[model samples]
Target: MTQLADQRPIAAAQEAAVDPAVNSSSTTTSAAELEQLRRARPRGPHRRSPLAQVGVRLALALVAVVALAPVAFLVSLSVRSTDDVLTGSWLPGGFGELAWGNWSAAFRTIPLAHMLANSWLVALGSALVTAVVAVPGAYVTARAGKRGARLSAALLAGYCAPPVVAVLPLFFLLKEVGLTNSVVGLALVNGLANAPVAVWLLDSFVRRVPVELEEAAWLDGLSVAGGLRRIVLPLIAPGLVAALLVCTFLAYGEFLFAVSFAQTTASQPLTVGLSLFQGDRTVQFGQQAAAALVGVVPVYVLAVVAQRWLVGGLSQGALK
Candidate 1:
């Protein structure tokens, strides 16, 4: 009986150990099954109903139509005759009725070629100047720590001040320097005006460059300028392109300064020259539209070409 009792206890212990191992095995299997089921479950896209997908697509289509409507109208109006435009037709007339002569007439009526050349010079020059000034300023400010922050803040303050407030002062200064009514003068003014914005934009891009790369260059005996040229410029090429395009667009579309400063046809840009289509009695709507279209083409082309870089640069800066 004693031997039997000992044997019973031994059996009980073995069963206990076996029960735990079995339980553990079952639990692990259950956990793995649960994980598998989770992975197999339908995701977000699969959960969306056909109706919901249709609704989303329809909403996007509607938004696109609404946004493009004005542009379509402007293009249609540009190709129409004055009579057709005056008749308030929303849709353009027949192909035969299209006033192709309006384009020729628009250029002939004003010094369109000269104005275009002047605008290009001012826009490109301002963009170049802004890039030259802003890149150095941004690099210096970004590397200067707290001093850089203070300097950047000061620039922002200057930029925040209304341009109109300083227009008269700037005009007088340009007049004194014999730069008034000249494309070069307008470019310089535009460049100065946009310098702060360029700095703000480039500051973000400059700071994004890895300090390790610059430090490596320094260790190799590269000067700051050399480091920037070798390491920084290539990295920030997109940001530079974005900034240049923005500066060009701003200078190209600038009407207030062009009108205020450039009085003569010889120096007038397209923005000011477009106003020549306006008569004291009645506006030549078709011809004005044609001129406006001509002026907008270059900007539109630039926007399309640099759109990816522009969006990426702006978003990257904003995120930083």
Candidate 2:
């Protein structure tokens, strides 16, 4: 009986140890499952539902199609014959007969080379010259005393004055001196008309440059002009680009003044060249379309090139 009792305790101890391992294993498995559940739970922000995702994708596709439609039309129209256009056909009846001769018709009708050259001279001259005069004027306006504010306000008021109202006086003034038909005279008018706009834009831009920067340059033995040339010029480049683009585009697209002033095809800008096709006999739609396109291409190219500078120039002045 003593031996059996001793054996019973030993057996009990062994069983207790085995039972603990089983219980611990079960607990550990449960804990692991709980941890996985916590990890798999959704985070704080709302989830993108399936419906919302599908709707977003559909909206993007629709917008893309809409945007691409015009480009598709232009490309198609440029190649199509008059019959294809008149019939409202989507594609030319024949695919291989795409006529590129319309572009030649456009060139011949509009005096494209002469207009292009004139437009380039006027646009480039106005932009570069405007930048030269406007930058200094803007710097002065920004740095001027309280008296300068009154002057600037007056100038801004004049800028808002109607160009139509000023045109009569301008026409007479140029006509009086026999400058009405002159390229230099036209450039002067363009520059003057555009200067006020440049002044306002550059004034705002100049105000944003930190005063401390100039002072540091001054302390380093640089003159005011030197400091401005080195520091201010580089920083204000975007504004200059933006301002130049605006001036050039306005000058290039100017029809009223060019119509009134330019008598000879030699002096006429691109804007007026397109109108010469309207003879009493007939209207050349193909030529008209071509000329319209030629006039637009240069302006489009100008805007595209200056787009980055324009964004920067417009924004920088606003914040400061």
Candidate 3:
């Protein structure tokens, strides 16, 4: 009986151990099954509720309307009759009564074609000059150490000084050289004015490029300028495009310098030409609106065309 009792306890212990093993096996099987089921389950498309979708769409529509309202008003004013404008009517009179003559009058009253040509020349020249000055400046600033940083800061400070402060001095200096009332002189001045911003922008872009890449080129017997031309330029093409666009827009839209420097139609840009619509006693609102619309077209077109590059360039160095 003692032997039998000992045998019973041994059997009980074996069963206990076996039971835990069986339970663990079952638990693991169940967990694995659960995981498999989760994987096999179908995931439907994410969908907003109908009401939520409507609300979101409506909010977007409202934003569009608010943003476009000013542009719509400008268009309406440009096409409206002079009588309607003089009578202070905020709304259009009629589609049939629209004054197409306002556009023609604007062209006749101002040398619109000449002004536009001059503006284009200045804008293009400024962009070219800014690129020339800024690319080198940015390269030096980005590669050099503390001295480059100090120089960059000085350039920015010069840009931040009110343009009016330098206008008189620049005018007198140009006058001495017989460059006053000349498109070339105006473009050069615009280029210099915009160079600081161009340098700052290009500096940011250049810093994003790895210095090791440039060093590797040096090891391969490439000069610094060669490396910059072949490698750095291609890598930062988007940034260059953005810089040129910004410089062109700045020079194109500049009013203070254009008005001060351009004394005659020969050198006058569109911004200065727009002022001719204003008489001593009265302003031609309809003709001015038409001219304003013409002025806005190029910027609008550029924004539409280069939006992708602009966004990409602006967003560079934002992430690791």
TM-score (all chains, Cα) for each model: 0.79, 0.68, 0.80
> lDDT for model 1, on a 0 to 1 scale?
0.86
lDDT of 3 by residue, 226-262 (tens): 9999888888788888888889999999989888888
lDDT of 2 by residue, 1-320 (tens): 99999899889778867799876877899999999999899865356678877888999999979966755665566666666677767776676777677778778776888787887777777776777778887888888856655666777789777777777888899898887776766777787778877887777778778879999989999999887789888888787777777788888887777777778888888778877766787545445556666666656675677778887777876776
Candidate 3 vs. truth: CA RMSD?
Answer: 6.9
* Alpha-carbon lDDT, every model: 0.86, 0.77, 0.86
The predictions' CA RMSDs to the true structure, in order, are 5.8, 10.9, 6.9
lDDT of 1 at 91: 68
**Two-way lDDT contest, 1 vs 2, winner:** 1
Give the top-scoring candidate (TM-score): 3
In the predicted model 2, the residue pairs found to clash are none
User: What C-alpha lDDT, on a 0 to 100 scale, does residue 176 get in candidate 2?
Assistant: 88
